[model samples]
Target: MVMDEKGMVMNANSDNLPKDCPQISETVNLIVHAGQKYATKFNGKMFAFDQQQWNVKPCAKINITFINDDQIRHQFMIHGLPGYLYPDGMVHLELYGEGELKASLIVPSQKKTYLVHCELAQHAEKGMKAQLKVGGGDGDLPNISAISSPIKMDAYSIDWTMLKWGGMVILVVVTLIFVSGRWLLFRHFSRRK
Candidate 1:
């Protein structure tokens, strides 16, 4: 882990290999940007990684350059890795604001999909979620921004009963306003005469 005035990095493994993997199969260089602009193509998202998914062969060592384009903190975290190599089965790289960081990680020789996201409050939910596939991955992760659908969709239901009551109340208010306004006008004209 490396920390400075610029940014912070955690669980960045460059040379260590997962026990299952005998050697590094390939080297993949990735440049991922984080900001709201990346979420423009995704509906109802506030933040996102420039790309939603990355593919690598099993035992491939990925060298990542993470860039945060927004003026707020953002993170690039890959989860569900081998616990021995990555603490809590994760690789985390973060930027405090609009900055960049570089790190590396070696994936195991297993065909699986690992979750990648920012762990900040509502950041992942908002759209900073992605997926890293090793050897094409077993399947897709749910609710990956612009990649897959959520497990349960959010519903913004309009209650017809509430709408009916609100309309009735509005009608009564308008009617009262009209009647009072007419009465006041009639009284003022009668006084003038």
Candidate 2:
């Protein structure tokens, strides 16, 4: 782990290869931005990465530039990596606040989907989560913002019992306004004629 005032990069591998991979298939430079502005399009979300999903070839090396636009701490972490290459099968990049950090990791030669998220408290649940797909990925992860269906969706159910009377009152008021306007217009036209 390399940490300083700006940020930290942990378990990053640029040249190290996994046991199953012969060599690096390709190199990818990915720039990911994390902030509240990125979550504007998603309802009830306050934070998010710029992209919800990323696709890469098997055994590919990815160099990531993580920029946290918020004035709060944010992390760019990848899980389910090869333990031999990455300690604890994960690569973690974190910015203490609004900052940037560059890190690299080489994925194994397997068709699987890896979870990428911010491990900060309530960050992932609030929409700071994404998916890194290797070789098209096995399948999609749940609750990945607008990418897949959440395990437990947020329901905005209203109680008709409480609003039924209020709704009827509003409808009546609108109808009365409409009828009154039409009657006034008709009376004025008749008088003019």
Candidate 3:
């Protein structure tokens, strides 16, 4: 783990190989930007990474540059890796605010899906979520922004009862004001004539 004023990096491996991987297959240079602007495409989301999915060959070494554009803390963490090479099977890169950090990790030779997200409270839930697929991956994770659907989706139900009555009330008030204004103008013009 390496931490400084700019950011923190945990369990980054450049040369080390997982037991299942005899050698690295490929190297991916991934530059990810995290901010509220990225979440504009996802409905009801407040934060997101520029991309929601990444695919790589098994045993691929990913060189990641994580950039946080927001003024708040954000983390880029990948979970469900081989525990031997990565402590608790995770690679974490975090920035306190509006900065960038570079890190690397080698995935094992397994066709599996790994969760990549921000660990800050409600950050992932708010849209800072993504997926890394090794050899096409086992399957997509739930609620990955535009990638997949959520387990239990958020309900945005409208109060039909309020809208119904409120709409009628507004319409009636507007009509009354228009009629009264016309009547006053008619009376004033008659008096002038």
> Each candidate's root-mean-square deviation in Å?
7.9, 9.2, 9.1
- Native-to-model Cα distance after best TM-score fit, residue 26 in candidate 3, in Å: 0.7
lDDT of 1 by residue, 1-193 (tens): 8999778999999999888899999999999999999998988899999999999999999999999999999999999999999999999898999998999999999999999999999999999999999999999999987678989757676778899999999999999999999999999999998
* Per-residue lDDT of candidate 2, residues 1-193 (tens digit): 8999998999988888888999899999999999999999999898999999999999999999999999999999999997877889999999989989999999999999999999999999899999999999999999988888788645677767779999999999999999999999999999998
Local distance difference test values of all predictions, in order: 0.93, 0.93, 0.93
Give candidate 1's TM-score.
0.80
Cα lDDT over the full model 3: 0.93
In terms of TM-score, the best-performing candidate is 1
Candidate 3, residue 71: the lDDT equals 96
Please, what's the RMSD in Å of model 3? 9.1
Which regions of candidate 2 fall more than 4 Å away from where they truly are?
154-193
- Could you tell me the lDDT of residue 2 within candidate 3? 99
RMSD of 2: 9.2
- TM-score for all predictions? 0.80, 0.79, 0.79
